[model samples]
Target: MPLVLFVDMDYYYAACEELRHPEAVGKPMIVGTGDTAAKMSGVVESCNYEARKLDIRSAMPVAQALRINPDIIYIPADHDYYDRMSGRLMEILKAFGYRMEVISIDEAAVDLDSMSYEQGLVQGKRIKEEIRKTLRLPCTVGIADGKVLAKIVCDSAKPDGLKLVERKDIVQFLSEKSADKIPGVGKKTAEKLEAIGIKTIGDIAKSDLVSLSSAVGSFGFELFQIANGIDESRIVEHYETLSVGRERTLDATKDVQKIYLLLDELSEEVYREITKNGFRFRTVTAKARYSDFTDKIKSKTLGYWTDSPEILKQTAKALIRELIEEKPIRKVGVRVSSLEMGNKQMKLF
Candidate 1:
């Protein structure tokens, strides 16, 4: 049996803030966007567990969070500092010398190869302690037979915890979890499963392939397999960088002119990086995160590869215009992919 370990940092952004300002450790605090003097116009990027108790959440308007707890400390987001911390965290994980996949800035999965479950527990403890001692941060670790299962277990044990679920106990462990608990099963997908009377993982385990497929298309096969304790997801040691992108949170707004202005700035940044690396891309994708934290993405693949900044700006603006019409956006991103090295003399088409 393959043993995988998933590590998730606790309340990552807020926790990073707490590290530098210990006085704020036990207080209700949030990291937000926009100028600190005008924080009410921004949105919460992250909040500590202390703030969560008062119903604060990421993407909530800072004004609303303040109404929930007037005394809550607010700090504007400093992504550069967080990125530095993430770099250091990755360095520590890499030292463990196991095949790993970084899921996000605050989460990663490591393949233990042939380690037994008992050995996996010991290794998990070692990782937890190393991170605590080195960075003064708390993290949770979950060990299981596969990546998805390990991630599920990790989430269940948060804010400094470690858990191990053996193969024999996988089904019982997953039985009561809602269908939406699976990583890729979002609210809409879960509602579809609910319509068919498949409310829990246990229900899916007992369901036939035809019934599951009829509800969620081809994803139902993976859902059924995971519910039955079969996860074939693997950890890759290396992933080729495929995209150049930039994103930022702004004062929540639906103004098309303001959004287009920001998109132009982001496009310039992305174009600089592309030119610096001698790469031309054929695809432009625009991403928008609404105030409710739901994200929508739009992509356009050009017929020809080019490094033209005008094309990048025009394509991104058109895509973003489509999404901004749905809701007020708190964050926006521009990405270019389908890359190839371009000669210095390549035409800017």
Candidate 2:
């Protein structure tokens, strides 16, 4: 039996400032673009719990945040500093010897397969204490039999708290929630469920198999399973992304020559990035968007991986030509995938 724990750092960027400058602890602090003339026009990346009281939130443009409270303290986001702290947190958790998976820059899940549910609860509190003691930062931990269950528990226990949903209590915990609480049930879908009188997780649990599947496809049944506290997904440690790419938008045009020029520009930039990253890729994909926002893609799989800029550019150009075939386009992108490290140029999988 795999017991899982999810630890999520509370208001990470904003908390970092409080940890470094104790004076900022009880005040509203914002992490955003630097103090330039356009500082107020920039984006707010994160804000402390104090700032949130005024409805200031992440992704709210700085201008709006200032309008809420002019006296709010602002600091430029230092991604390097945040990344260092995030790495340190992961290192601390990894020391616990669980099979760990980083959920994001500020969240992670660990498998406690060797321990019983009770043991996991004790270990979860220990982890929370160690992180606070070692980093002077606050976080919340959720413990459960699966990742999704742990995530739901963790989300509910925010602003520094710990929660547990043991195997036996999973269904009861889920039953008290809405259909939207199940992953993949977004606002629109939840409305659809509500329209059909499926308001709660328990409603979803008892939904008609045919109608539910028709409503949301196979995922609907999966949602039903989740409502019943079933999630077979594993705690994977790594995911190898198969591609790296870039895209650009321009005024819509029917001129094939103009499209070719855009493709050449994108190809060169993609090649530059690939070389800079020391990656060799065997697949080239070219994608285009029409004026109507419709998109299409064409790809070429090389028999052998190559780091040569010439080959990459040529393949990208050829794929772009074949894809558009003189059709009008509003945007174009080029990417190389099936990547490998160094000069090996051999597919690892």
Highest TM-score, which number?
Answer: 1
Give a tens-digit lDDT track for model 2, residues 242-279.
35577777788878788778778877877776666566
Give candidate 2 misplaced runs (Cα > 4 Å): 33-36, 239-349
Query: How do the predictions measure up, each by TM-score?
Result: 0.72, 0.68
lDDT of each: 0.87, 0.78
For model 1, the local distance difference test gives 0.87
lDDT of candidate model 2 versus the reference: 0.78
TM-score of candidate 2 on Cα atoms, chains taken together: 0.68
Error of 1 at 299 (Å): 12
Which RMSD does model 1 reach against the true structure? 7.6
| lDDT (10s digit) by residue, model 1, range 225-272 | 999999998876432235678888889999999889998999998898
| Top-lDDT candidate index | 1
Q: Which portions of model 1 show Cα errors greater than 4 Å? A: 239-349
Error of 2 at 213 (Å): 1.9
